[model samples]
Target: MHWLTLHTSVPMGQQTYETSIQQAVRDLAEPGWDFRASSVGSGRSAATLRIPQRVLDDRRGARLVGAATGLRHDLVHRFDLRVPPARGPHVLTMHDLPPMRFPDEGRLPAWCTEPLPSDVEVICPSDFAASEVTELVGARRVTVIPYGVRPSFRQPAPSSPEDQRALGVSRPFFVHAAGVTRRKNLEGLAEAWAIAAPELPDHELVLLGPPHGRREELFGHLPRVVLAGKVDLDAVGKVMAAAEAVVVPSTYEGFGLPTLEGMAVGTPVVAVDRGATPEVARGNALMTEPDGPSIAEALLAVGRHEIDRDDLVRRGLARAATFAWDTAARAHLDVYRKVTG
Candidate 1:
């Protein structure tokens, strides 16, 4: 079967989407599928473009997809319903409904909010996200496909103290790997770290990924918080391995990837009981409320090793084993076959 992968022209720093696309491409290619890919915005060639350049790239992408024909299915990893459906079945992967949940973040364009074309099937990473899309867009065809943790995350390697030192992270730290977005609850994390730092001496809170607007100002005052900025994937694995626990305090998530990654690496995770986090965590993580005090208590408990860390690690590894990229790829192929049939 032939497949056309439609990706958004996200900048290089948007690692999550990029990684998802890469994983999809790699696994799909392995099955000997006739696959082709095109980006909907400023592709790699024009990645550094400003707004006007991006508009031109979007137009170019639209022209390419619109003119293309004979593809068995077009899988859109980025949601842009404005792009008309292809000649064949169109599959859209909806990551989240952040705009609807957090209107203050920004209003979604009419195209995003409006019902998609009848031929377009939606793929949600979790049932939580699938329900939201169904309710908001009244979508009739939606499938749940959870993401797989990278093999590197599951590698059984000893903690890299040298790598941790290079990143300026000490041992026994809690890592927060998501971007500093409003949805990530960075403010709550900072507050929780401040409250918990006193109780757990020598324990630091490591913040990974790029800083969002005003994030530096908000988290700067917290001495125990270490803003490691953006690091390579190898660095991420190393840091995760050495961490006492990985904290995911997001109020919302389509699928909590970092939580899974931590679990894969045998690190305990403390995540909030919101959205798909509880579903993805699956009794593997220490569930907490989305408030500062609750997160603080959880962090303290984890740092003090009050909980059975060994048991948590064992359960987390087993849970992580259930998610595989090949499995997700097969599921996608099944969806494609079902849609085309």
Candidate 2:
């Protein structure tokens, strides 16, 4: 079997979901189905970071797309929505419904039209998003497969004093690691942290993220916040290791990857109970309200320095173990098998 993973949607200058996506495919794709992918455009400026997205933007039409499904595994999945998989039996995966343009217009875009392909089966990242798919686009064919995390064993608790010092805490700090996006609700986090900071001056707030648009406005006024922007995974793991809890205040998420990452590092999470978060948190997290006051109260718990570190880590590790690229990959491979021989 040959896999046709249409990757025409890779961003010109960014890594995007390449790491996990590749890992998932490697772990899941059906045996004998050598995976093959092609981009509609050269995306020539990609290396230079000047990658133009014009070609991708113009592919919203219901064009009769054609492509080879590389082998016994001639099944392809159109991951990039730019070009619909109209050529073969495809397992179309949509990251989100950000591009649907139709009678409802998503009630937003005007020029675009929904390309309802005849030979494609759509797979959504989450049920929350899947509901939108079926509701708006009249998409009858859809499946919900949540993304999986890399499971790992829990590291020994703070046995090394040096490790404790490096994380900048004898006690424990709260961590908020992710890109600074509007949807991330970092502004609310900042306010919540601020309100809680006074009550619990002992616990530090270490923010780990790259500055996205409006970041300056987001954290410009924030104080006592350690901005470890753009840290590597090792650094993130170390930071997660050092924290008392991880915070996620996203207004929405297709899949909360960071929450799972935090859990893998043996850090318990406190997240807004919204979108795929509750599902991702899976009862291991200390749920928090999205509002500033409510979030402040949760932070107060961190600031008061009263959490059972071992217990939280133990539960987090247990929860994290449930999600693994291997398991996730296997699940995806099953999907491929169902589609092809």
Candidate 3:
């Protein structure tokens, strides 16, 4: 069977979508399948379709092969729903409906909101995202496929003290690796931290990603809160490994990867119960209401050892173990078989 993979044109970075796609595509190998891949956007070149045997043979690490050319294929799998579907069998992984939900922040053109072609099938990372695709995007066929944690996160080496010092952050810190977006609820988290910081004098709140001008102004003066800036996944895993807990205050998410990452890294997670977080966390997290008081209370509880941290870590690791890239890739292949048949 021959197929084409369509990816969104995103700059190489630590964005969840980009990273998840890379992970998913790498494991999408099947014995009988012929793959050709290209990107939809113009920003960066298309994603690597096939890896060279030499690259895979490299003991040090794997390098991405060049983008494949040509569109002639039996099926086409798209990673973005924003682009129009091609003729014939097609599958799209709609990560989230940010444009439909938060119109002001992520408004899309009207064409993108139109119902997908009958030949198209949509895949979501969570049931919540599936519902959004059905209700808002008017997709007729949708599937939910949760993402997997990288092995690096599952059995991670601890980030040394020097690494922590380099980031200008210390232990007993609560890490929030999500970016500073409106849906991420950084302001709500800041407000909660302001209320809880005084009590947990030794604990610091580490905000990942690049600092936002407006959002930073609100919480920059807060005590013991470190804006660690954007770091790679390795650094993130290290910080998470050394953290007291991973704080996910986001009110909206397609799927809460940070919560799972924290769990995989054997750290407890303190997250607000909103969007797809509850679905992803599945009672493994210290879930709180989407408000300042509740978030602050959860933070305090984790920092002070008021909750059963060991239990949370145990349950989280167990749950995270079930989500594997191989399984997800097989599921994708199943969908492909169904659609092509």
Candidate 4:
């Protein structure tokens, strides 16, 4: 059967929607399926990478193979004119339509996404995402299939005091590894952390992602901020395992995968009540306003042991278990089967 895989426009080497989709493809291979693929986004990190030049050129061509028909073509977050995917059965995965409202740094082309029917099935990763799709493109085309977490993220049985000390985590700490983006609202989170930092002087802040230029004033003043940039999945797991909690401070999200990942590692999560975050992290996390006091209070509550770790862990595992790459892949396979049937 012929299958068209759309690689995410996300940065290369980093795990994002594209990475999750690729994993689903790999896992789907275990089942009975042989299919070809194509995508518009460049998963490559740098065009200057050592890979052959022909491969790079082929990447763009392969994704656009069916674009002429106006479907399954190049899609962006904004309301752009795009060729729609050919008629028949097809599955389109939308992480979120962020660019249309609050755009990223890049300027979008004239054609971002093509028009499709309400009955067309579009896969989303969270309830909020599904709702948003319905709000934007209508309900018939939407389904909520969260990206699955790799099973390796279970907390390492709660490291002992000595072990925690060795990892440089002697006291309770919170991890915030959001990329430097406007939507991430790192500055707002930093403002909150700054307020709480003094009360809990010993508390640590493991800032795993890079610094955003726009929020220089807020992120600049923070002391004892551990900037762990571009960490691998394994290392991230370790980091999350050690944290008292993980904070997702984004103003919006298509799927708050990290919140679930943190919970998968048995770390309690605190997130703002916004966008798909509420859906993805619903039962497993502590939702709060984006203000400083709210963040501080949420962090403090989790730190003070007011939140039941066992319950959080149990609920998190259950919620997280709902999403499996195999499940996602199987759903895609069904679509393909119907497409080819």
Candidate 5:
């Protein structure tokens, strides 16, 4: 079966959605399955113009393109640019309904909350995300396929001072790898650090993604908070490996990729029990309430080595082993076959 996957041309810095798509494309490219990929925008700044070009391409012939990422109205109003009679089967991957849930974020248009096209099949990264998509889009056919951790995440490395210095981070630090958005709860994490600071005297909180939306107001005054800015995926894996513990205090997440990444490196994860955080952590990492004091206590416990760190690491390694790109690709291939057959 020949397949084409549509993707965003813009570099999705530190976002695992792009990583998942790229990994899936690589794994699914095998004999009998002729897989190809195209971006919505070419390398130019006027990439949005490519949407119409895609429509023109569709007019040429029937081609099956996997809408491998979420749709934005500014990019394309419909799932496929092709009109009826010319349109072929196209699959969409809906990571989550965050825009619908948090409209104030302005990440998505109001019309995005409307029901999806009946002809489009959906792939969700987690059951939590699938439920959200089904409720928001009224999608009838939804498949749950979780993302995989890269091999770099599994390679063990010491939390050496040299590595920390290379990343401009100090030793005895807890890492939060998500972007500094409201949904990521950086403010709450800062508050938690303040609450836990009396106990965690030696540890600093290292944030490893780009800042957004009044991040200064949220984290500027936090004494121990270090904004490391954006880093590549390899650097992210190294940072995760070299941390005292990985904290994910997100109010919502589609799949919580960092939780697995932290666990894969044998680092304990302290994530709030919200959205898919608990599901992704899977009783391997430390779970906390979505508040300052509660999360503070959890962080303190990890910092003091109050929990059985060795056992936690062992469980995390085992849990992380279960999520692999090959596994996700097989599931996606199954969905592709079902849709195209």
Candidate 6:
């Protein structure tokens, strides 16, 4: 079957969704399958079917593509939740329902609230997300194919002094690589930092991701908290490698990539028990409730050297090794086959 990936979304710098599609395509093509890609505008290739961004942006564009090129393509797959109408079968990857869960988050478009087409095949990165799709979108079929941590995170080079200087890493700190969104439970993290700040006086809490306007309003009082806005994944891997611990305080996640990335980098991770985190953590991370006190307790445990850090890191590495892009690619191929056949 000839599968084409429709990449219509612009790169907004939160690399998770974009990175997943890019990595998947790279691996999918690695096996020399008839994998093709279509974007807003790009040079034509044997494997690339160029589609204008404006043409795809139109409400009728998806169906028009099917009518125009249906003979050439067997299936279409979208990486994000924006599943426009198509004449033939297509797959949509609903990363999470943040727009539905936190209606005011503004991270996703309002169209996310609309129920997905019943005919469209849905793909989720985790079972937790699949449940949401089943309940909210009323999707009859949902496939859970977990994401893989990039190889850079798995065998990360140590954070050098220059890398530290670039990301404003001045001291030993706990890193939260996920952005400060409502679902991220920044309020809980702030309160938790307040509780744990006294315990680890020498350590700082590093917040990474794009800088939001409400950041200082929420975290300014905490002198120990540093807002290290938006570092690339390579820098994130290095920082995670050198951190005392990686923190994931989000109340919800689709796949919780950071949890797996932290583990891949061989760092002890502290994540909330809610959403897909526990599923991703898999007993490799110190799980805590999604509250200030619970997160604080976990933070204190890590800071005070109470838990078996070596054992935690060892287990994390072993567990993270299982989620390979090759595996994800094979699973995706299976989905494409089943969908088109």
Measured by TM-score, the strongest candidate is 3
Q: What's model 4's lDDT at 213? A: 58
lDDT of 1 by residue, 158-260 (tens): 4577867777777578998886567888878888988998888888888888755556777788777778888877567667877889889999888878888
lDDT winner between candidates 1 and 6: 6
Give each model a TM-score. 0.86, 0.79, 0.88, 0.78, 0.84, 0.87
Best by lDDT: 6
Lowest summed lDDT window (length 10), candidate 6:
39-48
Show the lowest summed lDDT stretch of 10 residues, model 2: 102-111
Better of 5 and 6 by TM-score: 6
Residues 193-275 of candidate 6: C-alpha lDDT, one tens digit per residue: 99999888888998887888767888888877788888776778988999999999988888888899999999999999999
Ranking by TM-score: 3, 6, 1, 5, 2, 4
lDDT scores of the candidates, listed in order:
0.73, 0.62, 0.75, 0.63, 0.70, 0.77
Q: Pairing residues by index, what is the TM-score of model 6? A: 0.87
RMSD in Å for model 4:
5.6
Q: Mark the regions of model 1 whose C-alpha exceeds 4 Å error after superposition.
A: 10-32, 42-84, 103-107, 156-159, 211-213
Tell me the alpha-carbon RMSD of every candidate. Answer: 3.6, 4.8, 7.8, 5.6, 5.5, 4.0
Give candidate 5 regions above 4 Å deviation.
Answer: 9-15, 19-25, 41-86, 109-111, 211-213
Give me candidate 3's TM-score against the actual structure: 0.88
lDDT of 3 by residue, 16-132 (tens): 554565457566656788766665543233434333334433322221221122246788776765443565677888877876766445545455666766556888889988888
Residue-pair clashes per prediction, in order, are: 0, 6, 0, 10, 0, 0
Model 2 whole-model lDDT (C-alpha atoms): 0.62
**Pairs of residues at least 3 apart in sequence or in different chains that clash in candidate 3:** none
Q: 227 in model 5: Cα distance from truth in Å? A: 1.8
Clashing pairs in 5: none
